[model samples]
Target: MRKNSIKNIRINSEVQKELSNIIRTEVKDPRIHPMTSVVAVEVAPDLKSCKAYISVLGNEKAAEDTLEGLKNAVGYIRRALARSVNLRNTPEITFILDQSIEYGVHMTRLIDDVVGKEEVSDDGMNTEGDEGSC
Candidate 1:
């Protein structure tokens, strides 16, 4: 099967959803932050391997701990995945730390800071003009 085939896309979404549910409800590791989420899932076309992108809303230590927790629980996770989803072969999951969400948030804050500064300068100039006119 092609990488981007309709079947592959469907499988990816299904696996992503199931993995999210499993992590949210089944996993009971303190290291796994409560704000952990599965960002994306890519199951190989051959169904032999999978990459699961995970995003954790916490400090770097929390994220690293979450990854470690997930790695240690990979066996149970795979078994859970196998039971939840029917497939020819249960793919080996590779947990990947995805920082795209955090990056987007940081970029937004920078843009907002720049905009705020511009607004302040604009207001100061306007106030000076108003004082002169008065």
Candidate 2:
């Protein structure tokens, strides 16, 4: 199957959803943060391996711990995936720490700071102009 085929896309989304459910409801590792989420999943065309992008809404230490926790539970996770998703081959899931969400939040904060400063400077300039006009 082609990588971007409709079938592959469907499988990817199904796997992503199932993985999220498994992690959220099944896994009981304390190291895994409660704010952890499966952001994305990529199932290879061969269905032999998969990449699960995980996002943790916490500090770096928390993200590391979550990754470690997921790694340790790979076997159980795979079995769950197989049970939940009737795929020909239950892909070996590789949990990858995805920082895209954190990066986006950081960028949003920076943009907001810049915008706030600009607004303040604009107000100051407007006040100065009004005084000069008076």
Error of 2 at 14 (Å): 0.3
Of the candidates shown, which would achieve the greatest lDDT relative to the real structure? Answer: 1
The digit string of per-residue lDDT tens for model 1 on 65-122 reads 9999999999999999999999999999999999999999999999999999999999
Per-prediction TM-score: 0.96, 0.98
lDDT tens per residue, model 2, 85-126: 999999999999999999999999999999999999999999
- Score each candidate by Cα lDDT: 0.98, 0.97
Residue 74 local lDDT, model 1: 96
Error of 1 at 93 (Å): 0.2
Model 1 TM-score?
0.96
Local error of candidate 1 at 100, Å?
0.5
**Could you list the CA RMSD of all candidates, in the order they appear?**
1.0, 0.7
